[model samples]
Target: MKKRGWLYFLIFAFILGYTYTALVYNGIWFKFTDGLKTIHFLLYFVWFFVAFFLSLTLHELGHFFAFLFQGIKLRALYITVFVFHKTNKGWRFTIKPKLWVLLGGLVVPDLGEIKSDEDLEKVHKKFANSLVVAPIVTCVFLFIVILTFILSLIYSRSDNWIGFISIFTIYTILLSSLYIYSFTLSNPMFYGDFVAYKKMKEDPVFQLAQISQYTMFSLEDSDETNTYLWEKTRDTLKTIPLKNSIFHIMLLTNYLDGIIRSDQEIDLQIDKKIQHLSISHYMRNEQGLMLAYDLCYYHYKQKNVAKAYQLFDEIQRRVSKKLDPKLTTYYKKKSMHIMHIEYQDEFLEQIDNYYVGNSWIFESLMDPYETLKEYHEKLPFIEYSLPVKFEEETWCFQKSMLYHTKR
Candidate 1:
């Protein structure tokens, strides 16, 4: 574990230990043995949870409103697994629950459409405000709680003292948690509000990395964008530290730009470089997924059928268990059949369905789907053996190194 992770763990463990000692050793558990006592305990327990979720919701809304005020378009807002995103069709709701998301909620802004350094900087400032706003809201809530506690002490009647005390005690705990949350999430490991704010303010490399990723996802891979994006990404790559996880993204974008521009001198070993980074300890799951998506295509284009199928199978296994596989996984069986002409019709049909079905999602897949169509139109006759279906004994072991290696 990272040092920050250990500190967080110890903090939590200490809180739990102290709570346990209070309940069991200090006679608090015995005091709650009767019916009224049990009901009082239950009331406080329920109130604690209710207050906790309510505060979290307000914190995220602070980001949502901040984006609105900053004139930054909202991509999606997430509260645990549930997501609400803007689409051409309309706003839509979907569940995208993951282990990490269960801890907090956040709003995702539409920064994908950046076209130049000016656009990037404008979005960066707006995005920084969104991050800062959430923590400010949390602090405000803590301040309100402290004020309420002080007011209760001064104004409450003797008969109402117990009720005021109970409420204050719960709020006090929530306020303490909010403080801890602000401090803990500020660690870069969480990539939470403070970390994002710090990175945006202090690191030019991080700023350029953000643009590089958004450009790859949003920009059309035509002559207009290829040259400009390639130059920017190359400059970013030159300066980014090797240990940064986004260094892989810069490399991938550079490689993609080269392909789009038809650069004959482009390094053919780009996939190998990405594969090396995908196995690193710092690689994130989403990054691994993006790398796997590209690697499958690269290996297939290279006539390395076995490796392509292996990559595709891993993606398939991950997506199969998802509640909404279409939104999460790009390549279905039909999409995978694009390489072979036999399933060309099915592939085209599936692509149409995917576009129509996912029109409400935040990110657009039009460019990628069009690219697939173009490939289908011009793929020449080439003899190649069919790939075997991949089978791995352990799901954990078979997971992308990016997923398994994150600290």
Candidate 2:
């Protein structure tokens, strides 16, 4: 239904765009032969794309500078299809990107730690700067584009000016439409900068969640770091009412707590809470898989093979149906291997084949699993450590940013 809506929207958009062009350039239509010749059209195309991308870059940089203005150091910036991400090794540039990122570029601020109200407020102020500044920048650019279009109209006396006027008109209209749509539209799952800013101002839970999510993403992979996060999150959860919004964060906290503390009763409590939360909340594909993998491990550790298999069945029903078969099978096998126990070497080989350079998942799931310690010993010790690809890295960043606080 969502896809159908977007398809209908695109069809409507195309028709509307054609109608607008026909109306605006009625006078210039006769000059098409002189104005829209191959060379001229290519030049116009190049110029439009360059200006469009430049505007997008400036808008994202507005967010970047705003965060920096609040003294928040940034870790990553995504503009269009390009990504500038930082890791332990250093900052690296990546080409492949994520969807919806092109609508408004993303900046990942390094939110050091969320230890106090002061810390939370500090992050809030920094994010608020970006939300406020980026839209302002966008509007400013839109105004400039409109002004240029108006100027082209004012001087459209020559056949040479025909293409310029028409193209600028298209750019102006397209930019305006996108600006309005992005700023105003709201949904249960997604909202834009303007609405987000309003929520930041009006809702404290939304505000705290925004801050906590980034703070979680900024964590280094270490027992001490995980332990600290578990304690702090445990404290934060005590203060706020438990809700579906913070379930993923709680799931992560519980997973880390189980590893660090190894208390069976607490682990069982965490597993039950996770199962309850999974049933209550809607988890999208990759996000659902993250939770499923954790729960699968918990069930297996509890020596409940039936429960582990049941979890996989539920995954197939609710989440894995939407996922790539390879990805689904990979995670399924990784989780089920705990019970099968005989195909340890085959599983290790598969891990070597697919899990290389995916340090976050490895450290979070496999390395910490006590059942896998023997397999780890058998395998040649190679660092399963490298920064994740652009999509997964952005997922971690956005997942934490969007879902890390109690409502």
Candidate 3:
């Protein structure tokens, strides 16, 4: 286990022990028949649950509205229970929610669309404000609750309401403290917003972030050729250390793309680096989908048909389950693309006969070499000299043909 894992385990054990001792001391451990005690317990449980839900909701809204107030357009706002979005057509809501999304809403700004120095500065300011606003709003609301609780104690003649308010106030304050910790504490699984903001303030870090966003946009957009994006990704990875799983996975994606395009040979060193990284700690479901595709491709290339088929089957099973339809479609399309490359003639014949109605199947069947030459003729194909055992392998079949034909 990593240091973070150990720390979390110890904390859990401590909490469990403390809770057990407290329940025993209060004579409430396994005493379900005590009606009065049960009522009090139920009331406090309901109050704390409500307080936590409200606190978390307000905390996320703090970040969401902060971004809007700073003139930043959020692509999506997630509050754990649902994802809210403003699309080109109109607003949309989705029920898919993640724990990280609920703890502090993710504010994805159009950072790649920044075109000027002024725009960059505005974004940096807005990003920083968004990070700080959640904790700030949470603290302010907690203070208000605390003050109200105190006032009720001093001025209220009704003891019952005051007691309930006091407990509610305490729970709210505890929830706020957790909210602050979620963003400030360093964990192997997720970085706090404050930490991310601080890293973004650095020039190299900011440049890498910008480049990553651009790379993703190029990959997902309608543009066919990612030659420029591939080059930018390669150059940026050289300068940035693979300190985090996000960057590491970005590099892996670039590497996988290069291999698929036949622009670079598989590097064992790069593969070794990825193997060493803790991918599960940082990878989301979408990223996992991409990783699965890459692994399927890799296994196929290495002549491990069983493993490749297993991976593909797993992906298909996941698609049949409750995954987002859009995401499932994407994974299926990409997986088919990989299979098309590995089993060119077989896949082509299968698709040609069985999937004639599928537009995506037809699109994926287009000759990659022709597609690359058409969109990116000016860009030179990158050649990597691998170790002696991996000699004679090259990427970009069309680029190689064009080069030799020109010579």
Best by TM-score: 2
Off by over 4 Å in 2: 1-39, 86-104, 155-166, 186-189, 201-229, 236-284, 299-320, 338-343, 351-407
lDDT agreement with native, every candidate: 0.57, 0.59, 0.57
Ranking by lDDT: 2, 1, 3
Could you give candidate 2's per-residue lDDT for residues 271-353 as a string of tens digits? 34555655324345554465555665556555565675677677767763555665566566655554453344575564443
What value of lDDT does candidate 2 attain over all alpha carbons?
Answer: 0.59
User: Between prediction 1 and prediction 2, which has the larger TM-score?
Assistant: 2
Give per-candidate clash totals: 0, 1, 2
Deviation in Å, model 1, residue 232 alpha carbon: 2.6
Compute each candidate's TM-score over C-alphas.
Answer: 0.56, 0.62, 0.52
Per-residue lDDT tens digits for candidate 3, residues 366-388, read 33333323322112222223356
The sequence of per-residue lDDT tens digits that candidate 1 reaches over residues 1-407 is 69999999999999999987876785543333322232455677676666766677888899999988988667667676667766667678777544243577757665555557776678778777777888788777777776665455445444344354446456656655754466446433246667778887777666665545544333233444445556565555555433435545545545553553344233434434445543333223444444455556555556676776676666666543423454343344443555452454654556644432332332332345665445333223346675676667565566766586884
Give the C-alpha lDDT of model 1.
Answer: 0.57
- Cα lDDT for residue 368, candidate 2: 31
